[model samples]
Target: MAVWSLWSLLLWEALLPPEVTHAQVQGQVGGHALLVANRPSSFQVREAIWRSLWPAEELLATFFRGSLETLYHSRFLGRAQLHSNLSLELRPLEPGDSGNFSVLLVDTAGRAWTQTLQLKVYDAVPRPVVQVFIAVSGDAQAPKTCQVFLSCWAPNISDITYSWRREGTVDLGIEPSGLFTDGPALRVSLGPEDKSVAYSCIVSNPVSWDLATVTPWESCHREAGPGRASYKDVLLVVLPVLLLLILAGVSAWHLGPCSGKKKKDVCADEVAPEAENPLV
Candidate 1:
């Protein structure tokens, strides 16, 4: 059933006139948007009619040429303003106001033309949060180079845009990856020669924008010790194993005679002397 509804919507959009869906204007809920249009060039227009096209067609406003007053639909009272150029401005736009709208112009010569557009109203973008992660790039020229991934996002929003600005880290890799242009993420490579760096991310919608900044720590194997084991550490491990091996060899020699059939008798004879005189 849901599939059928989506199919029907696609078919409806496909059947719409090209002008009706050619462009889109975004509005912030509870904010205003100015939908602009130009005066017809051929001759003086005698009248203009603005109408909503979706959810059933309905008239929104009417303006007679050279008239001081414009008539608006009852629903649009105190919400819409009509301009001399036939442009429309809607204030305190609500989510319910999102839909297709068109304007009809009739010239004094009986010629007519129409321009249509779609509006998508959304909540204003909230302040974005910036996140950073680091990894090794292993580039040959700068071994130990760190690749930093920076992400910027706004909660509870979709279909918005992201941009980034960077500061600091002038010594090493300063140029960023392609995502820096418009993607929500960016990558930067830095080497040991590089210093600390900071990044800023800007998140925006058609109506509003917010920004966040963050500084990334160098990528590394830290906290515990050095990246490579030192010779002293290697000796500390090897010496203990060598000593244990020597002790095991000596124990095996003393126990070797006891492994065979006569071992029990020989072992007791060898141990009797030690048993009589204790080490202490």
Candidate 2:
């Protein structure tokens, strides 16, 4: 019986699952930090075998090797339950911990299983900053009417470029000036037809890009009176009607004691004692 038992223990230990460890970034600030852990997989192992042939905690401890000296240990998983699983967590993790770790698992018959896992850490890209400015490229009023000037600025990024486009075929006379300035400003003029024209300035860096556009001054702002509708006109014409409809719907649905669908339809009647005294 003892010999058979020893053979079974060796066989089970030989077939143990490979142990695994990993680090996941739950959260971090300036530098990267991570959680680390080792897990065991023995779900199908019979409970009887687990109780009779499992190795001591010290033997299971031998399979793991790493220094948590500089790593900030998370207290949650430090001590593990027996015959269950094991895990270790570290936070404020730095790049130095990026390496392979070796761990061991052994069964009672002195059979051993081994596993190795690799960890890595990295820093995120920094946020880019942007600036905007305005420039004038040509005369305000010219007889040809084609020669109006304006330019815009954006943040300067290497290898990224910019260009200008107009809403209508009517040209505002944009000359590249064969010059490039690292600013987020646009300069251009609209014709009499362009009183409502839309113009835009674009800025792009290798990592990111953004746009700032200015619509025709007339659409953006109003001089008041005559053509423009007043705020009072909108409030008086639309708001009260909408509010009355909302109030009527709410009152019809929930204001009464018998408002809901399940209420009884019939009411109890009370007999009147009319003229009882005179009749009697």
Candidate 3:
């Protein structure tokens, strides 16, 4: 589960924090790091011993240049190596491996030196999420003048930071407060000229960062809720129902005249039988 790779300059720029000395090295869990003591080669015929100093003090390795043989400690067995260049390499770093370490070096002339290094291991940062909720000045009535709240977060991580920023230029309307941020949340006040603008939320730690982008104008400027229909949609539905009602009224009026004609004809056909009897 361990393999060594070349440490590129760009990788160090991204991982190393500010004000850290060359002796300080940061790595991700399940990754590799090479710790160098930066000892000058002029100090010849040397012996070196490396030890873990913080959290727990323990011996890592001991090397003698004359014998060209090294002894390893159980803590770093099968996972650490002492190189000829007087550097220590650790692969597949563990979470419990963070702390301070030092190396004691003795030259042929009996002069001794000690170098200390700080090691830190971190978990990779996960992708962040952005969510938004909008509130109008008069409930659902004053949509043009409303507040938009956006929240950004990453899950289950520690020692992280949140930052909010807008991508491009924006023109604010009504309230004209524009945008303001507090920690992971941002508040925006929409006005008349409030066009669509992109916003980014960044979540980061010392070693990694992730960002999410959203445009609040898309949701805030929408005139209709998901459950409500637009004006054009309502007209499209009502026009068909009105046409059916007008057709029904015309058919009922035509049937009324036919019924009256039929009644008059029946009376004429009945004749005056009583009058005929009197004439006889």
Candidate 4:
């Protein structure tokens, strides 16, 4: 009877306070789906256990080393005699890190408690690369054609399937290179006006997926037009030349030989003298 009573007392004493049991550490990347819990308290915690769904090969010791210190900070606090909650950190997290984990807590009296965690690792997709070149028409106002080449890169991934999506449109078919190449380039034709449209690339491995968006631009279409003069532009230029010609004509008319008095009367004087002699 005494043994039963003592065991009951032990169980009650081992039961944590509601607040302590409710204590947790939560970290998420991307969204709530990628959350992890069970950060240690900043008080005297006797033990901490880390379990990860990530592949043991992918997880390095360096990742867990700092987190261990972070979890044990409560034990080192000189002023406040408070125990801190434990935390889990993995170094060099990979797509495989997506899954579940648990941390077991052992008390000074050797009793143990465990917490369950659901961890989701999101694979980071490499940004899609696109190169665009434009061909213009003779008419400056006319639309131009844009030639685009797209490629995707994720060196960390060995085998992957790729897909291209236009933001406002549907999916385009994927071409397989069968192996990695420097120019995994895809050619797409567009108009200069459509250069503002965004293109997206979706990269997927067996474990994860990543996406990247690139705004299309044209090299030839970047400028409004080449820095040159047109017929209308030349007409604006000729107006000044025409104004100068008119000004010169008016100045000559105002101050010229035509405006001076005429030289006359010499020949008429000789004839008048002959007529006067006959009369005498």
Q: Over the stretch 164-226, how does candidate 1's per-residue lDDT look in tens digits?
A: 876652446666444255788887775555445667788887788888977654333331124
Give one clash count per candidate, in the order shown: 0, 14, 4, 18
C-alpha TM-scores of all predictions: 0.57, 0.26, 0.63, 0.30
Q: Which parts of model 1 have CA positions greater than 4 angstroms off?
A: 1-24, 68-75, 134-149, 168-193, 218-280
Q: Order candidates by lDDT, high to low.
A: 3, 1, 4, 2
Clashing pairs in 1: none
Which candidate order results from sorting by TM-score in descending order? 3, 1, 4, 2
Best by lDDT: 3
Write candidate 2's Cα lDDT for 31-141 as tens digits.
333223333453322211211011111111211122111211222133322222333233445434444443344544444444444434433322233222222224554
lDDT of 4 by residue, 100-192 (tens): 554445555545455555544444445544445443335554355555566666565545677776666533555344222233455566665
Off by over 4 Å in 4: 1-124, 133-143, 170-183, 223-280
Which predicted model would earn the best TM-score? 3
- Model 3 scores a C-alpha lDDT of 0.70
Candidate 3 minimal-lDDT segment of 10 residues? 1-10
